[model samples]
Target: MDYSPHPTTAPSPPPATGSVSGKAVRPGDRIFLGLSRGSGIALLVIMAAIAAFLTYRSVLAISGDKSNFFTTLDWNAVGTEPKFGIAVLAFGTLVSSVVAMLIAVPVAVGIALFISHYAPRRLASPLGYVIDLLAAVPSIVYGLWGALFLVPHLSGLYGWLNDFLGWTGIFSYSNGAARSLFTVGILLAIMILPIVTSVSREVFLQVPRMHEEAALALGATRWEVIRMSVLPFGRSGVISASMLGLGRALGETMAVATVLSPSFLINASLLDPGGGTFAQNIASKFSEADTFGQDALIASGLVLFVITLLVNGAARLIIARRKEYSGASA
Candidate 1:
């Protein structure tokens, strides 16, 4: 008689994964997936198309240059032996952007911190609203105001800087009108301030209540709590905000054109009036330039495009490096 216990059969293999079993996706999910993928592909295609166009135009312009396209300081793009270069443009753009960042970032952080952590709710809400409103103000308005009101009023401050810091060469001035790269930087800083402050304030407001409470429980002071918990969590966000502000300062055309007294010559001192930015140059010259001259401007535009990409790339790297401490990772 077969009385022995039947040999235990091995457990059935686990049900096939979603892929093997062809688990059905919801219609809504499938639609969303397709849309998102299509959007991403479209963005890449558009970017590639723009890059190709810029490259082709730039090659034609550079091929026609009579001098070193990157090093020459002349910008006579008219006659048969035409010459122009971006050396001064590059210098002015970088210097002005750097100065704007230096002036705007710390002030923006302070304003954000005050709004987020220190101000009474009554004051904070209205103040934040005002800052947001400032952001909505047009860049051209800022440019006009800068050129008319701000520049005239800045002479005294420029003189003060020259008196105290002229030996540094950067602050040295020719005692002329205050239409200089430094002034352009100041205008850019003002234009970008609302953006940085708004973004930073939002980030600071998003700090975990529990983390702040824990710091309080440990008898930490307000500043100490912020330094340890809030700042760490919001560092990446602040960086992103700064990068956004920088991008605005970089590609600003109307504002720069309206404010800057553009020239092809590079001045050693930011307080000097002789310098130009790519955006400023393009905006100021594009209308008057001939076909080949317009192509030259496009070449400069290509350089500006490359610069903006590099700035964004660097900002991404910075955010990624600090992701561990940022709430983004959490």
Candidate 2:
């Protein structure tokens, strides 16, 4: 009997040599993952500790005899009843930060655009490095420069604005003293400029080469290419950078205290020598504070903490949306 030739069956490929979805992990990866999780837990613990401490101290302040915490303008924390509120401080923070953003965001975007798209490579790197260096400079040094150099020089400019734009109200000056919210804003702008510029430059540089090339291929001018391709792509990054700058501006203590002569009242004109920020108030008084005063200061710090958290959260949401948009486009 002749047996028919058996058809050959290919041996199944050996099972994948490595770990499967349900397979045991290597000891090294497990250890690393454990360490990462532990570190994250530790970070959360630290944040909790800080929040608890701040809340504890602030409750002492708010629960004390102070008036409606939101409405009272008085900030005297050294009386029998120690009245204080963050209204002026909040206003000052918002005003100075807004001014700094107005000055810094445009200039920073321009500088970033230049470095990313316009400048020659050799020059661009060095300038970028210089700006990065500026960001590292100590706040105290900036404060000294603002007080010694900027304040004196700004007096003349203040006078000019008063003379020419007094009718505009915002630029009107009272007595030619440059130690006003405007001056503080200018100083804050200078301090935050490098930070915004560096971040914005990096973001702009991240625009896809293919997109830039496509724009150029379509006969778009270099500026137009940047406007259409780079800026829109980096809009989220720009907002984040601006918020970072705003954060710094809000918390800038020494420079603001050095430049601002705080008055309790709120004024519409940026030229008025009025207002105090949370950081400024804290720095100016922390060293001399009694227990209640220190508590009040901590309470003000709580307000700042809340504001910063809100800003950063908004920025995170904006970035998340942009990332989604980019993912969809890709």
Candidate 3:
């Protein structure tokens, strides 16, 4: 569908009328407007192309599959009977991301508020810079750190969780190396923290100073001021920041591959060395996979891509819903 906005025909300014507007079509204006409209059209074309490619490859791979594409537990789409599913991969991806959100969002919000509102004026800038620097560190470095240093140090804590929360089954650790969903979530949390904090900090910082002053004049305590004046204003910003972090967590590949032990089964034990995310699975399997296997991987990538699109769409709706009231940008 050609939904890109078309350039509207606007009458020339009254002072410039009676010229048939031919002479009024300034070359500079024509070039600029044409370029802008063309860019929009180009973007639409690119998006369409990507969707078409994913759909083609995914259909080719799944056409011969015998198993329920959504329910099957294993990925074996390259065999004579070609059976595969994204259930396990999707589950792990969501679980790890959920864990990351659970751990990261609160901490990120707190740090953001601290940097924007609580930190000394002189220290705030430097602290924020440090956080931004953390975000700049390449994902592979995080992967290496997670594998080489974090894995060994996590076994004891995993054992403790198993001992104390084993009855719940969810936290039950299998005494395996700490390459599990929880560990992956922790690494993801660290990796995403800087970005989330940076976004939230900017949002909170943009809250109208008058609002804060009004709250103070009304004798609101610091905590109460934030609760009543700051938080309400930045709620959308915080949501946006969290969504960005979730996006990063979802697409993270190298870090996840390095920190997780891949498997096809889904289990309740979050501290065990098993389960696989979409990105992790694709990266780990693609090079060694046959042609059909590659197609199957592309199918999984399509799913991830769709998931990302849905997440972003939802975030946009959420932000739009609250735009009228959020004073974070005021």
Candidate 4:
């Protein structure tokens, strides 16, 4: 018998374990990648849809206006050739939000620092939990508090401010009710306090132990350590948190509607009772608005949406411009 009549096959080599082999995609990873990409696309589509709808409705309101939408002080859109404008509302909204940020950011940062670094270790966790709880309080509850309690209690302070700063005009008090832009700003600052505090506290808590230790080893005082090591590292996080608070202040509806006595005219005095904000104006007038009036409110709402988008976009751009922002965020 010839030996070539039958042959045996060799065993196959084991799967390669080289660097190129290590780069092979796993099935699970491919699935995850596809899911994430699809989710991002869905989000973009939803955002685009919302923008298109808001723009469409706003244009319908603006098309028949007899007055300049940007300059007119009146918001009377009742009859044919209706006319209205957001000038007063925009002024009030921006002023109130600016005041809120001015009051909230520094106070929030200080409170967060105390909770994260200055509070007793035994007390820190409980204090943080209580601060977080403040954020969960209902907006309507805050509205009631502002209307019933804060507005009445602020009269003395308003009087004092008017006595000293009345010449500036914005701080002038003309014996009107305390439901003014200044009052609304104070209420908004209190409302957004929890959000900024909680976010900043978390960021402060994340500061690397090594960074603090290095500062200490270099003979820095506690305050100096925080100033040099913590604040610089966490600046971006604080800015982001403040932006979140500002967004809350800008879009707040019920609290503002309850606290503010809205007027279409721009008052020089923030301590006066008459000033309108976009969200507050809409809430106060929507039920009584005719078809044209409702459309006008929609147009103002579109302006507010654009304002908020621009604010958040500006904040993101600011954060992105900081070289340390990415590292701090991580």
Candidate 5:
């Protein structure tokens, strides 16, 4: 053997045949890339088309509207002057969604934590399955249940709220039928709880094992480990889940229509039986509306669409900012 290596040399790498990371692109990968790109482009085209249609129809409706489209609470789209506005719809939609979020987020987070960290494996599996089943329950079924069962049973609770919190005005009740925005909010909270809980549970489960182990090694309690490690890692996910639930609550139609006594007037109290949401109004009026009325409803729908997009966009921004904190970047 020679004392020195006999002219050591590295083997040449394969040449790039197509657009790839210094390697030949496979047929399967190329096909998948094309399919994914096509799907993304198609989705953008569809969304743009919908926006264009809604804008056109909304203009047709707004051009003839006599009332201020943002201020007036009246919704007489088929009348001679055809005055309509989204003030009350906006108020009801915002208030009910707020109420639903306030009720659902904490409960969902607690349930999620219990299933992910506190519950035994034997108990968690069945509970998670039940939550999945609840999510699959149809909106129409929820609507019927809310209308028939929830509305009737909530009167006593409403009375208690009125007695205890009536001075706040928002919780004040006037002995009306329990078909109010507050009732709608409660129903929506129940409807969305399963979704939020499922998402949060999955997020919490994704916390790095080493982080939890390290916390325990440092003599941290289980609750402290969760507070210091699990919560920070899952904050973004919880926000995303809450936004998803809020979107559902904002656009819920049949359930809200069934539970709420629709009116054009904005009520001072959520417990009062008089308010309307965009989805409920659209579903109730679309079938009976004339062409102009349909256009007006479409205008209101456009507003709702814009609102939902804004909410989701804001959630995305928040998640993006906190992605590194959540260890997603890592």
Candidate 6:
């Protein structure tokens, strides 16, 4: 009985609670969170600063007493009046970009498909590396190549197009040389091709292996399996890649400027040697431009910025929609 009474021991204390939900974060975690927030804020501030600067410069051009700021096709920034408008610039930009996309998209997708689905593993990696290298090459180099080499060789192609498609008007070429919108487009396509192909190939490779295997097990042909499993999954990615290429095509300055001879007129012919783009005009005239002329160029740049933003935004929306549809189907 004495032993039993001595056996009674003290009970253990209850566990300490830091918060109501019983969750505790260390000092390191809090510091990391603060750093992340700071980084985000800094990015936003930088973006805002850039936007403000561009807006300030552009307003000077837009609000100046220049005649026909939006309609005139002239780009004589050094002239006394310094009259100019985005009409020709916009046309050239759109024409070159559209042509580039037309040439690049198909080739890019095909190359991507071949690399992801058809090429041997060793060959695919090397080829992909080469494409990436192409993407990394400087724009100025492309410009020089276009100016010195590509333009000379394109005369034959231009002649063929003019001869066969002259009645269509779009391919009509009055100039004997190949330095035209079409040639610029072709050069742009070559420059942007690597980018589009690399993006597309990466996307296609992300397709689920199980889905591809399932299609194969169901006795589908290789092409059929790809059509069902790969292309569908990568459709959004392909669009995104194409849009990236389009952005590059649209904003390219040195290449277009070096290759294109700008005349202030909007023509329907893709073969026309006369047209300009905002970037090209800026690059061509910015150095010799006066204060007001610089402002005008900045204004054109502002317009280009807006256009690029709109295009990228539209592309994001399309990709988002495609993702939603894919999720629904799954």
- Cα RMSD (angstroms) for every candidate in the order listed: 10.1, 9.8, 5.7, 11.3, 7.8, 10.9
Q: Name the 10 consecutive residues with the lowest summed lDDT in model 2.
A: 1-10
lDDT of model number 3 = 0.89
Clashes of 3: 0
Clashes of 4: 0
**Compared to the true structure, candidate 4 yields what TM-score?**
0.85
Please, what are the lDDT tens digits per residue for candidate 1 over residues 1-330?
Answer: 112245344344666454664678667877987999999999999999999998999999999999999999989889899899999999999999999999999999999999999999889999999999999999999999998998889889889999999999989977777889999999999999999999899889878799999999999999999999999888888998899899889999878888788788878889878798999999999889999999999999999999899888887787667654542444
lDDT string for model 5 (1-330, tens) is: 112234353344555556555576677988997999999999999999999999999999999999899999889988688888999999999999999999999999999999999999899989999999999999989999999999989888989999999999988988868999989999999999999999899889888799999999999999999999999889888999999899889989999988999888888988889889999999999888999999999999999999999888887787667665654455
Per-residue lDDT of model 6, residues 1-330, tens digit only: 011224344244455543543557677867987999999999999989878999998887777736677788777666656677888888889988999999989999999999988999889999999999999999899989998999888877878888999899998877566778888999999999999999899889878789999999999999999899999899888998899889889899999999998788888887868798889999988888889889889988989998998888888887778767655765
lDDT of each residue in 1-330, candidate 4, tens digit only: 111334343344555544455778787877987999999999999999888987888888898789899989988888766778889998999999999999999999999999999999999999999999999999999999999999999988999999999989878897767999989999999999999999889878878788999999999999999999999878988998899789889999999999998888888888989878999989998998887788788889999998889878877776666535544554
Residue 282 shift from truth in candidate 2, angstroms? 0.6
**Candidate 2 local lDDT, 1-330, one digit each (tens):** 011245243344667644574576688878987999999999999999989999999999899945877778878888787788888888888888889889989999999888887899899999999999999999989889988899889888888888999889888887756788888888899899999999899888778799999999999998889888998899899998888888788888999988888888887889878888999999988988899999999999988988888887887787778767765776
Give the winner by lDDT: 5
Best by TM-score: 3
Collision count for each candidate, in order: 0, 0, 0, 0, 0, 0
lDDT of 5: 0.90
lDDT of each: 0.89, 0.86, 0.89, 0.88, 0.90, 0.86
* lDDT score, candidate 1: 0.89
Q: Which residue runs does candidate 5 get wrong by more than 4 Å?
A: 1-40, 320-329
Runs of candidate 3 with Cα error greater than 4 angstroms are 1-21, 24-36, 326-330
Q: Candidate 5, 22: how far from true, in Å? A: 14
Q: Give residue 29's error in model 5 in angstroms.
A: 11
**TM-score of each candidate structure, all chains considered together:** 0.85, 0.87, 0.89, 0.85, 0.87, 0.85
